[model samples]
Target: MFLAWNEMRRNKIKFGLIIGVLIMISYLLFLLSGLANGLMNMNREAIDIWKADAIVLNKDANQTVAQSSVNTDDINGKFDKSEGLKQTAVIATDGKLKENATVFGIDAKGFLMPKLEDGKLFKKNNEVVADHTLKTKGFKIGDELSLSNSDEKLKIVGFSESSKFNASPVLFTNDETISKLNPMFKGDKINALVVKDKNWKDAQLNKDLEVIEIEDFVTKLPGYQAQNLTLTFMIVFLFAISAMVIGIFLYIITLQKRNLFGVLKAQGLTNGFLAKSVMSQTIIIALIGTLIGFGLTVLTGAFLPEAVPIKFDYLTMSIYGIVLILVAILGSLFSVLSIRKVEPLKVIG
Candidate 1:
């Protein structure tokens, strides 16, 4: 331990550079994990809170909430208790709010309405529930807004937490208003039916109406699977790079101090003590750098804009921290083995 402490003091700059690299890698891992988790949450949180056992969509429409179409008959015939929703893209603009927005027309009295964080749910044709981000972006209650897909000018009736789907802030409205706005909709039907019953028989559902689990539907969103996969690959490669960087730095340090190690071995120091010291130094450096990096990530997250989705939960951070420490320990083991190979006889000659 004494020898390891002395070596670290002797080569502070080299150790500092190694520590800097480790910090950067650890920070990137933390950021990427948060990003992946955040994106998934943004796409699915509203659905997640529904606590519904099943979601019914059009069988031919695949899993998209926006594309699936189900009539009242499709739902009333099978589902014990169900709410119809029409997830469509209609351009909306408030003369005062500025910028055109995509609207998500849904049933005001349905299961979806309960997710509203503030104000009242949509009740009238003129009423709409906007996401919190939009409120910051320039929207307010009682503000009259015009929807482009249809002829209706609506009013903001409520606000919801940052509910976003396909990167667009969601706007909640009654099914009647949505049916009037969306041109693609054929009848007074919904894009999908949110089912609350667990005993729903999929076989008995209307042949055209497909019953999809909410979890499965979330993955079907365009680019969701691809985006998630790309982020996962990036995080994994960074972890590998972190391990290699630590190993190489310690290896080079051991080589530079070979003569000194030999002198100590000849002076009655056992190889085991020298090896343990090197490992202890590696672990100490890894721990200090990781902690610093994690702190930086937390601080940076505080300033991040709501538009830049980054999710960090305790479970995700804890798992990543554990992996970082494990890799650092592996790097230290290499240094310990190298220290053992330093021969006293060679140095005396």
Candidate 2:
């Protein structure tokens, strides 16, 4: 370890370059994770907050929640015969305050709608809740805003924080009001239904309606799979780059110390010690680089825009940190493979 430390100290520029590369790659990975998680949360936070055990939609609607429509009668007999039901909808409407908002039409009386950050839920027709961010965007109680895509208008009745779906702001309103605005809706069918009952067999429920567990429904959101896949690729490529950079840096430094290593070997130092020293040096460099990258990410996230869709979670951080250390260690081991081949006799003969 002392030998490794001294060798790294002697070639500060080379070691610094390696650390710089690792820091850049790790920073990119952390940012990508945040964007992916943030976008997903922005897209589905309200639905996740619903905490529904299961959801039912039209089988023909496929993966789109907005496209799926279930009639009131489809769930009436099934809901009453089973346990409970909560119908939900995602509507694209012009903001009552902002110009364009992707609103989530939730039944005020249902399990998904009454969570308020300020004001209250709809108690009468034409009432709606706006996202807290919209409060600054110019929406207030009793304000009537026109929908951009449709001629229908919605009245802001309350405020809430869980407003935003797929990186767009959300509004919570009764199903009737949303249906009244949407021409496709016959004032009867719902976009989706949340079912709660232990006795209700999912397979049987699917026979009558397109039934899927709540968690699964979340993954079905458009662009979710592709976004996640892209982030995964970024993270994987960064990790590989980190490993290779550290390895190559260490290998170059070791080569520079070939004569010194030969002298140490002649003095009876073991190849194992040399390898351990190399690993220690790599770890030290990696730790410093990672800590710096992590600190920068935290600071940047603090001031990011609400619409930016960035989430920094502990699980992701923990996993990234562990992988970073391991990659650095692996890189050191790889470089050390050349250590055993350095012969003292060849240099001093």
Candidate 3:
């Protein structure tokens, strides 16, 4: 510990550079994880709220509820403990700013109907409850939203929590409003069904329909898997790069301090003591850099717009921090091994 601190104190700028690099890497990783998690939440927040066991969608819909279509036979199938759903995406406008939003047609009394955070659920055919984000966009109770592609209009009766789908705002309405909003999906039909039994794995019930776990349903949402895969690869590669950067930097320093290690060994310092210093140096550097990086991440998140999808999971961040420290310690193995191999006689000779 003394040798590690003495060298770090003597070469403050070199070690500072290492810490800076680590800080940037850790910051990027944390930021990326938050964004990925937030986006995932937005894409499937409604499903999370439903707390449903699984989803039943048309096989042809590619597992996306918005693209699914359930016929009368499918809806009336001898299924038990399920509620039908009619879902679609439409452009909403108030004769001014237009934006895309998702409309969910669910039974007002079904288990899928979330408890209102404010106001009441839809009591009439066209009365609807919207996500609070819509309220931010000038929508409020008693305000009418015009469906651009259809003659149907929605009366906002209430507001729900942060329920979103396909990275867009959500509106909850009855099946009547849904059918009118999109005539093609009209009739006694539904886009999908929500099952209450978590063990509902009746995939082969009908060749045209399939039941899937909630996680699988979320994973198959449009662009959800793609975004996750891309960000995961980037994070993994960044971890590897961090290890390489630390390992190479320490290796170069080890090369420069070969004679110093030999002289210390001659002065009666055991190689084991010198190796402990190297490990201690790695731990200190890793902890300092990661903490600073996390602080910066939180600071930046505070300034970001509300629309930015970022959710901080402190537990996940802590686990990442531990992994980073372990990786850094592993990186310093090259230095530790080099120090252990130092022969005092060779340097003195």
Candidate 4:
């Protein structure tokens, strides 16, 4: 360790360059990871808030929520004593805020809906609760928003944090209002049913409907699977590249010190000590680089635009950091192998 420190001190510029490269690559990997997580949350945050164990969709809909249709009567009678909630979406906007928001028609007493960030849940047909994102787009309590293609207007009574679906803010309303807005949906017809029972497969239901785990349901959302798969592949590729870069950098550094290592070996230094020094140096450099990268990522998150979907989770970040360090250590094995092969007599001459 002392020898490794002395070498680093003597060649600060070379080590500094390698550390800088690592910092940049690590920063990029973390940023990409944050974006991937943020986008996934944006796509499924509203559904995740339900905390439901499983979702019931019409088998004919092919696992898609939007296309599925459920009759409230069937769900009520078949799943008696079970908490089954109906939900659906419609394209809506307030003219000033023109985006295709998903209107969720849920029972006010059900557990599927999330608590409001401000104000109360819907108590009437015309009252609605929306995601916090709506507030950012010029909406507030008492503001009346209209649906697209219909003259019906709903008053925003509350806002919930992180309540977004399919990249759009969610608007919670009652069954009555949704039925009034869309003639095709009458009485008990709903897009899907959310059930609290994890053992939904055992529940006796019409053969036409299928039960799917909530986590699996999220993947069925349009483009959700594809987007996540692509980003995950990119992250994996970056991890591989980082490992290779570290391996090459340490191998070259080890080569430059071949004569010094040979002399030390001739002077009675054990191979284990030399290998430990190399690994210790690699770990120190990796730790410094990872810290700098993570700090920069936090700073970037702080200044990022409100419109951009980006989230920083400490657990995820920690996992990423640990993986990076492990890969770097693995990369240092090449240097250890090179050290073991060093011929003390040949290099001393």
Please give each candidate's TM-score.
0.91, 0.89, 0.93, 0.93
Instruction: Report the lDDT tens digits of candidate 2 across residue range 1-349.
Output: 6766787788788788888887777777788888878877876876776666777777887846677777666576565222222223334334433445655556566667636888878767667787775675666776786765556677777888755655566777665666666666665666777766554443355454677777787787877778888888888888887888888878887887788889999999999988888888888888888888888788889998765778999688868977988988887776688889999999666
Candidate 2 residue spans exceeding 4 A from truth: 77-98, 133-142, 198-208
lDDT winner between 2 and 3, please give it. 3
Clashes of each: 1, 1, 0, 0
lDDT (CA) per prediction: 0.78, 0.72, 0.85, 0.83
Off by over 4 Å in 1: 96-102, 183-188, 200-203
Q: Report how far off residue 113 is in candidate 2 (Å).
A: 1.5
Error of 1 at 67 (Å): 1.7
TM-score of 4: 0.93
Q: What is the lDDT of residue 141 in candidate 2?
A: 72
lDDT tens digits, residue span 183-288, model 4: 6577668778787765677788788888888888898888898888998999888888888999999999899889999999998999999999999889888898
lDDT of 1 by residue, 1-349 (tens): 6766787788889888988888898888899999999888877767775777778888878687776767776567576777777777766677755654556666666667546777888777767898887787878888887766668787888898776766677778775666567766656577777888878654486667777776777888788898899999998888788888899988988888888889899999998888788778877788878888899999999999877889798688878988888888786777788888889899656
lDDT of 4 at 318: 83
lDDT accuracy of residue 317 in candidate 1: 82
Report how far off residue 33 is in candidate 4 (Å): 2.0
Steric clash count of candidate 2: 1
Worst 10-residue lDDT window for candidate 1 reads 96-105
* Alpha-carbon lDDT of model 4: 0.83
